[model samples]
Target: MYTFIISIILLVAGYFTYGKYIEKMFGVKEERATPAYVNQDGVDYLPMSSNKNSLIQLLNIAGVGPIFGPIMGALYGPVAFIWIVLGCIFAGAVHDYLTGMISIRNRGAHLPELAGKFLGKVMKHVVNAFAILLLILVGTVFVTSPASLLHNLMNGKVSLLIITLFIFGYYILATLLPIDKIIGRFYPIFGALLLVASLGVGGMLIIQQVPIPELTLANLHPDQMPIFPLLFLTITCGALSGFHATQTPIISRTTQTEKQGRKIFYGMMIAEGIIAMVWAAAAMSLFQGANGLNELLATGGTGLVVSEVAKVTLGAVVGTLAVLGVIVLPITSGDTAFRSARMIIADYIKLPQFSMKKRLLIAVPLFVISIALTQIDFNILWRYFSWANQATAAIALFVGAMYLFIARKNYWVALIPGAFILYTTTVYILNAEIGFRQSLNVSYVAGAVISVVLVILFFKAAQKSRAAELSLEVDISDYRNIAS
Candidate 1:
């Protein structure tokens, strides 16, 4: 209890202290006009209330990730609490803030453009392909998951095909409409239900006096998954995810001032960190204990555990409401994945999105691709999504380090996390289900060597960036506003 309580306090306090420090370190200026106001075309780039931006950013990133991921992480026992609290403060929130601020500074550029600016053109091209594929996977996965859950909750009253079409229709509408009309208006209510559900579970746990799992380093996982890296991957969204970087540009185009970046970006991540903690505790307590949770998880899937937890904790109509709120989590994210995909496509083809016809030209094909992707099994989609998601994050973290190095500010903030994540993802690929299938020992040795080399490259690049800053061929600032 003491560990959990202190961790929460540290994260909230981190906002005023570390969050503000990062904002200053990145050179946020009050007088600089943001893209939303400077490049308003009444479409993608338009000014919105800071409050609305915060809510959209929250739902855009949160989805079912914080709830579902943490529920799986709990199978590893109470160690998840430590990871969520510390990871959010030092890594996740930092990643989200810096990436968003970087986008703002570059005239609200998306991740591919930002990556191209900081990294080289080759990386830019690679990330462009990566960003599109990942978004499609995310969009399709979120669509099917929610539609299927709604199907189950209704006890098959609604056909899955009909429900999926309805959900996909929502995605198309949200993707095409102006920000304020659909997403900005509806997200707040969905965000409220999400917060209420998580908070209600927390309160019920305390009132019922359920046994909260004790904090320990002991591995309680029945599958014996190593905690060093698997925990990091399993708890991807709550701790750090590359997916958040893709979403950042969506809100980036709407920010009114650079000053709001910390609150809108960093502050929302910390709020998500809290939501993760609340669900982790509730899942453990409601199952009687962490050991019980591992047993339950072993027998079921993420969606199963989440539905059971909500039904058992909230109960009756409120439980149903909470489950509906959970449904909103994925549906919100799925639509925005397409929205982000649309922005990427517009930028790629050098097309503007002011007219409905132009927007359809970009979106029509993207939806067709997503609809086909939904046919692949969920487990396969998730495997690709999991690795692709973290791989993107590792790349984003490296891109951030490059930004810091080019500016000649302290680069350690991004560099350290970059290397750690790089090492973990590399090791996971080499040994886990997806990659080379090498032994763990081989993965560890190779990962360590590569990580060290990457660190060395970062420093060398910083020195070269110092020498090359004024002579770069691309002067992106010349048309930053008129372009993406």
Candidate 2:
């Protein structure tokens, strides 16, 4: 219990201290115009209030990952709390803030464009393909869960096919419409429900004095899976997730100022960490122990655990509302996942999004692909999504590091975590069934070698980029002297 409370305090304190420090390091220019005003296309780049942007950003990235992931992470005992706090502070929030602010500086360019610009042109193509595929998978995977839940809630009065089609239809509308229309207006309410649900569960746990175990380094997994990469991957959104990179650019376009980046990007991630901490605590305390939680997970998965926890803690009426809030999570993220995909494609093709025809040109095929992907098994899609998601994060962190290095800021802020996640993701794929299926020791050695080579390459690229910028500045100075 003390661990959970201190962790929450640490996350909040991180915002005022580390969040502000990062903002300053990025050199926020208050007087400068933002993309929202400079590129007011009415479709994607529309000015929005910090409050609205915060809520929208919260819902955008706070999908079921935080809830489901942490619930699963609880199987690792209180050690999961350590990852939530440290990862959220050093890695997750930093990743989100840098990605969003960098996009804002680049006129709200999506991750692929930024990755290409900072990392390399090759990365641009790689990330473009990678991000689009991941978003589609996210959209498709999110669709099934919510549709099934809604179907269950309605007790099959509505067919699953109909629920899914309706969700896909809504995704189309949300994707094609202007940002302020459906998403901006509805998200605040959805965000409220999400907060209420999370806070309610957390509050009741404390009020009832649920005996949440104190923090420990024990690996309490019933299967005794190693905690290194799997735990990191298992609990992503609440800690550090690459998926947030794709979402951040969406809000990047709508931000009214550089200052709001802290609140909208960094602050919302902390809020998510809090949500994750709550769910983790609830799962740990309510389930009796790691063994009980594992048994429940094996039988019914996290969804059943969530329902049971909410009903038991918050009671029947509010529990139902809390579950609905959870339902809203994936729906909101799914819409934006499709929306982000549309924007990425539009940005890639250099198509103007102002025109409805142009928007459909990109959005139509994306949805078609997403629909087809729904036919694939959910577990298989998630396995790929999980790896792709972290890989994207590693790339984004490297982009942030490159940006910082070029700007001559403290690049280590991004570099250290970037390299660590890069190494972890590499190790994961190498050992997992999806990849080479190598032994863990082989994965560690190979992942270390790969990461070191990549870090060296990153430094070389940063040096080249820095030298290019320096040359341009010198040329400009000489031209000014000539003009004088």
Best by TM-score: 2
Per-residue error for 440 in candidate 1, Å, reads 0.6
Q: Write the per-residue lDDT of candidate 2 for residues 1-484, one digit (tens) a residue.
A: 8988999999999999999999998888665677777777888988889999999999999888999999988988888999999999999999999999988888898999998888778999999999999999999989988887788667789999999999999999999999999999999999999999999999999999999989654544434557888999989999999999999999988898887899999999999999999999999999889889989888867778888899999998999899999999999999999999999988898888888998899889988888898899877987898899899999999989988888889999999999999999999999999999999999999999999999998888889899888321111111121110
- The TM-score that candidate 1 achieves is 0.94
Question: Best candidate, lDDT-wise?
Answer: 2
Q: Where does candidate 2 have its weakest 10-residue lDDT segment? A: 475-484
lDDT of 2: 0.89
| Root mean square deviation (Cα) for candidate 2 | 4.1
The residue-by-residue lDDT of candidate 1 on 311-403, one tens digit each, is 887887788888888899899898899999999878977899999999999899999999999899987888788788888888888888888
Clashes of 1: 0
